[model samples]
Target: MASGQKKKWVDKMVFRAALRRWAQAARASHRMELSELREHRTRARRLRAHLDKLIHVAEERLALPMIGNQAFPRPVDTDWAWRPELWCGPLPVPGMSSVASQSMLGDEATMFHDCAQSELTLRQVRNTREADLAAYGLRMDVFRFDGSYLSLAIDLPEEASRGLKRSHLIRIDTIVEMEKPLEIFARLNIKHGPNTEQIVRELPLHEADINVEFDLAYTKLNEKRVEKLWLDLIFEGPEMNQVVLRDLTFSRRKRAAL
Candidate 1:
């Protein structure tokens, strides 16, 4: 072959080699950027752990309880305005996800989720107190969320509701305080099927978080209709009080031995 022809062939081979090298370099650059992004995500996860630890320490000192610990964290919905104090963490930058776990939903303060709802605003009446009781050493600070719609909901799980029947006795340990003497009426909503039926009963207003027994003899849990139930402790008259509902539990009306 002529020298000129040979030289042209060499040039073509060199150009192809250069193009391949450039393509490889581009791929390597993309991989490095991807790796860096992954590292950043890992670092953010560590930061979340650190922030949660700080919250736990602070709550221990102030006696504040968080919402959930081991349970799955709830995605932020209407909670952006006022999150539980313990959830204060580095603001999640856009394009990043925040990790959370169910921590302390059952404390003195109001809880606002389904796992352990202790809504501070779950008073039976919107702005009134029972007629026969006065505030009895119940202390709470309005230092937190002003839109205090934190009404507590007592969740009756499916299993519990299924086992429950009419005439079943329920033992409750609660603290009711009133500003004046009046009788407090308790309104309970037992959800049966797709319907919500209300049952109203009266309890004497005592100025203390007291223990009471709710005899289900008259409650008449419609076996065919009773799906689940929630109680609303209604303060009949005007007496500003905080009722510390400790627990609302049930005991089967055990059959007597023959």
Candidate 2:
């Protein structure tokens, strides 16, 4: 063999031997005595810290940019557009099982239910599809759901309600995939000084893309007293099913006067 090739092969064999030795030491760490274990732990922690940094950098450099990109379509006359933080980036806590009522997944999204025994899971997964614009997606799995009510509430940013008026129309677009047939409703709630206005629309699951619009002209909304806005996604008969929300977006535009 060439000298250069032999040197490379020797280096690889040495690295493999070192890795095996470290693995054996880690496997036997549990049997170590208290003082010895403490010493071993200190060294292991230092080694782990360096390894973690290397792994983190390697993953970030090699993987696609899937954490912060938020680009989606909007109406021609749209004044504002938004994509919730949960769908635009990774959450600090990504997944939860046996979720309780009023559990929050991130700063903007919350899970609510009335089940006596919780059998639900919520996870934020990377959107690998080429056509997907959002960086992340939310996946929900339900097994033997006995809840009387189930909903996922997302708090809209303050900008959504800023300079609000009665002539504006709010639109919601989403891409959802379900393992079986199910019913879902999207409700928009706007809180004013002392009252709240709500509008509900059923999602057409049969369609490839789901879209709904709420015309503020129809609601008795106090434009001057608008304080906050939010959305609730209610699900019916979600038992023994899996649902994936690939993307969700919001936009606002002025309604044409009659």
Candidate 3:
């Protein structure tokens, strides 16, 4: 064969070898892309399935007996966006009240962080409500040995808690240890969007369980919103005495929710 022809044939063989390697690389890349697409679709399908289950659970809870009644009150039904495990279910008996609650050091629910002020102990905890009693009724066991023992509850207002600058009422029920007759103070923590303030008032002059309810007709709210709130129960008297708080609950009326 002529030398020039032989050289041309060798060049053609090299070109064909390079073309085979490029084809193999292209096929591998295409397979990898297809596998990734499949994985993404699987993940999306799982997420959608989970969301469906959550929605179903929320709807079921809204159907429970007297879901929005006073004692067994229902959580605020916001728009269908995020759902918390705390909301969708037959609520574990409200051992405290319809909404937020607080107790002294040894009291029920959970002990407060500060110990320098008073020492509170949990005496008993009730999870169920009696037929003759109110909703989410709890018999919280609490006794104060060093300082004042205060238990508080804050109930949310309607209108999605919007345009409300302050709490509608401050309710206090206390069992105090009398050392020359003590005095207790109750404060309402109200927040409206960016503004937060404390509304404080002293308890009645007496012993035993003093049930107090404050009206919010005085506080002004203009295009306000309430997202969080609480109450502080303070006792003023001799530092050493024992006080007991039995039933602390939130409601529209003095009677318990059925």
Candidate number with greatest TM-score: 2
Please give each candidate's TM-score: 0.36, 0.75, 0.39
Error of 1 at 91 (Å): 19
Q: What is the lDDT of residue 221 in candidate 2?
A: 90
Q: Which residue pairs overlap in candidate 2's backbone? A: none
Candidate 1 residue 184 C-alpha distance from true site, Å = 2.4
Model 1 C-alpha lDDT per residue in residues 1-258, reported as the tens digit of each score? 799999999999998996796566556655667777577558658867988999988866444222221122222221111121112221122111111112123332222322122223332211113321211112221122323232333443455456556644443334444333545455556777777656665664444444344455565456687777555544333224334432233233432234
Summarize candidate 2's per-residue lDDT along 157-234 as a digit string, tens digits: 999999889999999999998999999999999999899999999998888779999989989998889999999999
Give the C-alpha miss distance for residue 154 in model 3, angstroms: 6.1
Every candidate's CA RMSD? 19.9, 12.5, 20.5
TM-score of 3: 0.39
lDDT of 2 at 2: 100
In candidate 3, what are the lDDT values of residues 7-48, reduced to their tens digit? 999999998996786566556655667776577557658866
